[model samples]
Target: MHPLGTVLRSRYKIIHPLGSGGFGETYLAEDLDIPTTPKPKCVVKHLKPQNQNEVLLKIAKGLFNREAEILYRLDKIHNQVPELFAHFEENGEFYLVQEFIDGHDLSKEIIAGQPWGEAEVKKLLRDVLEVLVVIHQQSIIHRDIKPHNIMRRRQDGKIVLIDFGAVKEIKCLETNTQGQVTSSILIGTNGYMPNEQANGKPKLSSDVYAVGMLGIQALTGIPPQNLPEDPVTGEIIWRDQTNVSDRFAEVLTNMVRSHFSQRYQTAAEALQALTQSPPTPKSDRWRSLSNRKVIATGGAVLLGSIMSLYVVSRYFAKSPTPPNPQAVTPQPPIVTPKPPSTIKKFSQLPCDSDQQLSSPPPATGKPTWETDVYKYYGQINQKTKEANGRGLMAFKQNNFQYYGDFKKNKRSGCGRLSYPAKSNIDYYLGQFENDEPQGLGYLKLRNGNEYRGKFAKNKCQGEGVYIYADKTERDGIWREDKLEGSDNFSCKGSSASSMPTISFLSPKPF
Candidate 1:
């Protein structure tokens, strides 16, 4: 255990031990560099290889550094992720400094005997799914995503994901007859991990499976380990254990399907499904029809038929049976055409916005076209249209809004576009030409990823600085949104002057 009051790098003073796991120990600490009334507290994690063998230790060290890099990048892009402050080796162990979150882990809230209501479970699903979307987009999987790893922030009640300690490549060394070593490692939690993950071939959907298990646990009040599964199909049999809306039940069932193909492919897809309205059941539709309307229609039809029959009979009696050579002509029964079924169209989710393009009026300053465009577009507006001066056009829908300068009715000069509602990207403050992003500007995505540099026709092009979510910056030339010939600039939080210079020493034999 790290000594209490012990200081690292002459800055972070260890307060006390927080927790320990198979690979490392964590501690609460205070940053002495800042001269605030009360020094800010932070978390310090010590990463030590479980195996002391030289070959295994070397591999573990490499994995540890890589994990640090992942955490650093992810923190920059996601608010829910913990920030990495510093990472360095002390003695034989690697230590990481990170922002401290004062809150209780979700395990405390999800008690074993207490079940969460539909509303509570739904809220939890949204909160966690949003974070997963960012994580998956970065190509990083949180192999371990249980209640213990999730914390509810006391300040804002936001769910914060902690512990990237499990984000490492496992190495299992094997010796052949010729004395050559080969290695592989499988990583995941038993109850939450899917078959693919357990087989060491985890995909993005593996994380989705874990989240589904979490939802099930919340609803059933039973821990994942205690829950039962089908022996042949391997699907979780959870519906019988809890009472939830059929829509939510269907969603959870799809999410935790035995086959990854049957599950929601991505976090965004899962989120859309969660927020979507469920299809009305046939029985429920009949219930929705008004009883009075059905009775009134039936009564009207019956009375009309009786009246027609009486009138026909009276006419027949008055005219008498006319025996004629012509046989009674049989008329075709009245046929009523059923009204065409109206297909219900569901509203598109925010994630679907990427497929849609907003088309404003052209450079023509005609009032009629402008008004018509506004009416057709619904949310578009000609905020300011001067004869020859720079004009401003605005488009807004819900939380997304765009204000740009227009020349000859086309987007020109600088513009600001905000899309807080989008799941993929956020706002773009940059140059525009012909209503498209062109020249230089800054683009900030919702996942905390940002690019500052040249853009052409709305794609990242030419020289630019791409800052990843983990706070790593890459400076290079980009083509069609792809970074090319790029090199790492600098770690965001660490500085040359403040960071300690280190020289590796020969490893002591185990």
Candidate 2:
């Protein structure tokens, strides 16, 4: 390994070795100068060139790609993930630049014999849940959530999750609506792995289960790897800890349960309980969301159906049955009906305070619209004889629409947007990356309120516009779904800033 200082990416002056793993070695690097404020430092994870197994190499490359994807998704939301600095390949090798945290991975503490303190466990997990709030909101799942990936800083005593090398993202089933691909990274350290991941049903709750396992180990002074196991009976040796608090033991037991349905579901639910005065994590909502059984379509459409593997596939694989358009026989009416001067097919609907629009008309055609693959609006013809090179999956659900990809059979690819799409409704149609909106898209509201702008995983990230159907509108730069600045609105005004925001409400449908 390179000694104290080895320059990398030309700009990063390597300071010293931070850590090393089976895959690669990490280095502390300092940016030369940018003339900003304090000196900038980052981390460089460089793959080891010595490993020669081709199959393993392919797996490593896949993991590297997964890591990059995980970091990209994390950067889009409010998680504790480190920012990506750069990713490049050179000299038959690959490298990734990332934010360097001045902390130790919790693995270090675990190895050094971390004491089982209930408060300490709660504090660490509380922060992790806060981070999960943002992560789950974006539909991004860090399949490999373990102590080693969590960087606990010494300076501020805060946690910054690092090493996404083992992460697996949850694609919002759409482009490949079939759950064809389940990631094989198989993250987590043995005992910490939930049955879903081990038995292959992992989702957002998989990470929650892992975290809960970590908490159990921390609270009871039992190392997960070495936790007692009744081999003959196939039971965990946590009865003593259960004696401490039936509630805590019950939570831990479920967390490590072999069946996904038996484990904790959402981080939100567990966090809510863990953060409570006595740690009473709820199971209902978490279970509901977990049992959703999200799958990947070659399209990004989410057909929210929960069932066993056989049933789910049978339901999803059911081909579109073309309706007989010629079933209606013409009937003669005794009296001739005169057509009205104008056809008023749609009626007005309620709108927001300063908005106006019509609700979508009663159902006609199919209750659900399935596009072969959604491309840019007006870009891909829904009814195209020619299967263009491009492929995406999309479908409508109730008043909203959501999408993602076909990961072999698991949700993969990218861009799964779930936004309302009513006739005159103003809803968010966000451009997605790895399922959640990540680029530019649009939002339409029920009152004919429309906003089109840049989005970073569903939230407004850059310049956007809010327009009304009656010729009123507002356009401006957005930070987190909210607009920034003052400009000309019909009667209302906006606050202006460097980005120069503008906005106006509209009136139409009504």
User: All models: lDDT?
Assistant: 0.66, 0.52
Worst 10 residues of 1 by lDDT: 343-352
In candidate 1 the C-alpha lDDT for residue 364 amounts to: 31
Give a tens-digit lDDT track for model 1, residues 185-273: 45667788898888877888888898999999989889998988899888888899988988899999998998999999878788989
Which pairs of residues have clashing backbones in candidate 1?
72-470, 73-469, 73-470, 74-470, 363-408, 363-409
For model 2, give the RMSD to the true fold: 24.9
Q: What's the lDDT of the predicted structure labeled candidate 2?
A: 0.52
Candidate 2: where are CA atoms >4 Å away?
2-4, 33-39, 48-69, 107-115, 167-186, 195-201, 232-235, 241-243, 276-510
List model 2 lDDT by residue over 297-402, tens digit each: 3113443334355554674577465433243232333587854411111011001100111122322344222343322211223454222212233332233333
Q: Which ten residues in a row have the lowest lDDT in candidate 2?
A: 346-355
Residue 90 CA displacement from its true place in model 2, Å = 1.3
